[model samples]
Target: MSALAMNETLTIARLGQRGDGVAETVQGQVFVPFALPGESVRAVRDGDRAQVVEILTPSASRIAAICPLFTRCGGCAAQHMGEGLYAEWKRQQVVTALSRAGLETEVLPVVDAHGVGRRRVTFHARREDDGMRVGFMVAGTHDLIEVQACPVLAPGLERAPIVAQHLANRLRASNKPLDIQLTASEAGLDVDIRGHGPAGDALRRQLTEAAERLDLARLAMHGEIIVERRAPFQLMGKAAVTPAPGGFLQATSEGEAMLSRLVLDAIPKAKRVADLFAGCGPFSVRLAEKAQVSAFESDKAAIQALSRAANHTQGLKPVAAEARDLFRRPLLEHELNVFDAVVLDPPRAGAEAQVKRLAASKVPLVAYVSCDVGSFARDAALLVAGGYALERVTPVDQFRYSAHIELVGVFRKTAGRK
Candidate 1:
């Protein structure tokens, strides 16, 4: 065996972004896969590098992953850490980010909103001579690891790949690959077929036939390929969800609904609500039924979705949609007065500039939902410096069995009444 092939015992000092055990051997820095922090491992730096010869000491937070594909699939990184500890790591991550920014706010314990109505999911597919193959990318590479089921998908979406593969072949359109996205709602699945629309209903019929054979929930097609059944979805705001394929949405249905409710709980009943960075208006539309919901997003497509959802309802507060480069051009101080309560849901980058504006603004209340702890914490600090008391930071387990943590927090001026 080559010297590199020999297994050597080493201790992992820290965790890497991809959840690998990051440690340095006397020889050099070595990254061992599947080794947990605090564990001592004997590993061979194989091309696929990882081996846990022995765990000298285990982390209190270390826990086994439930999914068989947990280690091999790149979709999840922190699954090996148990839920309780996972929540804490995420919480601490958030706290640390805020502290670095000089913001102080009380972060509440994480909330678990598992097994509920998550709205949108995107699936990948590959064209092959035999047929189309679909599944998530293999853990770290572009290579596809085809599978019949994905535990992370909503129960209905487990067959998404199977359905998409069949349609691509039946349509005789293997040249253009397909990305199938499913969005769920009370009405059912809204299927968005992205990439290559077939010319007419004749093609739609062939696509429909393919969908029927696969036992799909609903079916739609993009340019050339057909979409399978799932849910009837409109992007919610002015967004098409298609143009921005990776737009942020609640990864799970339960978490999405819960986040909306939390915002409602935090804000006092008001005539207006400002949803900053609102993608597709899931919160804005729901809130619009009661209070006028103003949804702001950088993407025009998202604004359109919000507008349509707003128009569909009655006895509902009006929905106003606006497109702005928020990161570049955030709402000014004078504009903040239009809203009594602000519901800001930024991406993992979080709302740093918005938080600064919020802190200095006289707005009485704020509801913040974040996916990344670091950004959330930084913004939380800003909110704190602005005289807002961190009412609570509740972690929402939208991505179960994964290290990612979502937080919904309500903040208000310390001097202002709750």
Candidate 2:
């Protein structure tokens, strides 16, 4: 066997699932980051992974990255590709996953839901000898890369890094690594700091003063509220939801609205709808506008927020919420039969247990929202085998210039099949 060379020029044949370029080599397939297909690049090979040393010939799809920290920060992966190629690669992710599951269906063009970019941004902070360092971690390393500006953030969150640094400086006395989650809401920035222990009276006072100076709407530490200048509320259709501290939210407002529209349109006439894995009633509250919604989630805070929003809103049908772990005790066939349609937005793992029961139910329509295409394909195949036909699949690009893709699949029960 020929010895594998440490440095070699190779042609990228394709893009991998994580947005890395795959180059076939004598040793094996080398995964090169920031190299697009049809491009020739020189890389230092280490087994299957390679670090691109230089681009010998760039692909036609290659484009300059908007962010200066594109290669340094782990937040984005596909920013170097042209807009058309970027969208096609993301769409292909869904198509490849469904193909692997032996399912073929019509997939609509990818939706550009990254309107003004992400509304929520998380920055890592640590006390430095000079002062404090706040930024995203380096790609594939724990080292922090201090950022002065970020291009992918919404206009409302343009000062997120600065705001995080300000908080880090105020809490520098703790000398602990912290994760500052800044979410842009209608009121103002909702700040949540994690990894810090319970604050003392002095620290609490400092935080209060910082919040006032920063003009923050609310501040929380370790999921506990410290101060509230105003309620950090998000409008979902006609309902107002104050999500829990550090709770899950759609990356962008446009993405949430797009996903909700796709979901609602799938089950248009659903008299009774069951929203599984409902987080803060993003889909449940909207669905309730035309259907009675029964939302089930594991987070107590999320369920409370959903119920409160549902109760306070007017002209909507009944909306009930239960804090239940659907993974452990999914709504069974008989329980699922009560609802005419079901909508589920499961995490990356894709709600296997709940999907199994849903496949056995007599529900006429289903809207499956997923972030992980592989898991979505697995569950989708299950539904297909259970006599449901995939009506349409729409890929949502909430995380632009990155490998991550979100999708909503609409399925309807077909006749003459159990």
Candidate 3:
């Protein structure tokens, strides 16, 4: 390889975050996008980027990407890899992160999904002179890209931004102030709107009339805008929109079901459980059927959803929901002993201080769900150093084709401890 070369091929050796193909050519680390971990391929080592040119040796894991927007859409990155391989890679990603962090113990099996289920997606939109431009964030930046279709819309609002923009234009023609939300639910289109500038009777009529044209079932309006009576719409059989802005929850019902199952199974044998960072009762409601669950989340709005979920379940024990900033103020060390098992579903940052306290609190078993492998590994090492034995690690494909991977690992307290 010369100091300055236009095009050169490099064999990929491993994987990294952002779903890149990692390789080394004595030039530090070269990451190849769109290439799997174990592929001996001709990748053009561009200045800051690498592209797969030819595959000399392909890992059994490589598969044809199904989505048409595999290269264009920024929603997911690993779609081109085989479904089974994708799952395996995800598991390995966590294991690698953990192993490097000094938790070089047994990493368990992983589960595969034919298609990653994405329930909800937020699209960016703005009114242009010609038409309304709408789509997802650009690959590396927040610059929005206009798109016709997305694989991740919950259901009813599959073409939400497009449809909403059209309605907004009609309202504009009729001179109405318009803010809109089109929620996806099996129950159908439930919309909400808030407006202040223009919506007169004519604009309001136009907005509702446009929604009627789209065959929407329920619609509510405020000022010059039409909005869903409730946000997020109810999923499955629920009767309300229970999503908070930017607060993490499963985007797809299928994903939620899969993720919820993992949390429930993590501590199946336990009686009393504490579900940390339990947002909107995803796992808490599911686990409630089998065990007494105490749920905790930082957001009060999320806690409200958990409270409602607890009230609705029949045989399930309503989870005790508490709202607190676990980062700033973690669960007290003494309080960790109140449960037989502790289940944590933290965000990408993973559980550190909480895991440290759990290890010190003498909890018998802990199941942690994490989005970041590196963080999971670090936290797992802390637990292991504190004498927690690794039991099982399961990775689920929630967001398919992307660099992001979700994992659930169960750790048991080491035996014969002093």
Q: What TM-score do all the candidates reach, one by one?
A: 0.79, 0.97, 0.80
Q: Is candidate 1 or candidate 2 better by TM-score?
A: 2
Alpha-carbon RMSD, candidate 1: 4.7
Measured by TM-score, how close is model 2 to the native structure? Answer: 0.97
Q: How close is candidate 3 to the true structure, as a TM-score?
A: 0.80
Worst 10-residue lDDT window, candidate 3: 223-232
Considering lDDT, which of the candidate structures 1 and 2 is the better prediction for this target? Answer: 2
Q: In order, how many clashes per candidate?
A: 44, 0, 19
Off by over 4 Å in 2: 1-5
Q: Is candidate 2 or candidate 3 better by TM-score?
A: 2
lDDT of 3 by residue, 1-418 (tens): 3465446667777767677888887767887887776678876676656777788888888777766767666777876787666666777787777767766666666654323345445555555565555567676665666667665554456767667667666544433334565556555555555453545676667667776677665555541225333244344223233544334556556666766676666677888888898877777777777788888889887888778756865666656889987777778768988788888878878778788787787778888887788788888888888888877777766666676667778888877741
lDDT of 1 by residue, 303-352 (tens): 87667657766556787899987788888777987788899989889888
Question: lDDT per residue, candidate 2, 1-418, as tens digits?
Answer: 1266488898999999889999997778989999999999988887888889999999999998888888999999988999888888899999999999999999888999998889999999988796889999999999999998888888889878889999999888888999999999988999999988998899899999999999999999988999999999998999989999888899999999999999988988889999999999999999999999999999999999999999999988999899999999999999999989999999999999998888888999999999999999999999998889998899999998888999999999999764
Off by over 4 Å in 1: 1-6, 13-18, 22-31, 45-64, 116-120, 171-173, 185-188, 195-205, 212-248, 352-360, 381-391, 414-418
Clashes of 2: 0
Q: Give me the candidate number with maximum lDDT.
A: 2
Q: Model 3 Cα displacement at 374 (Å)?
A: 1.6
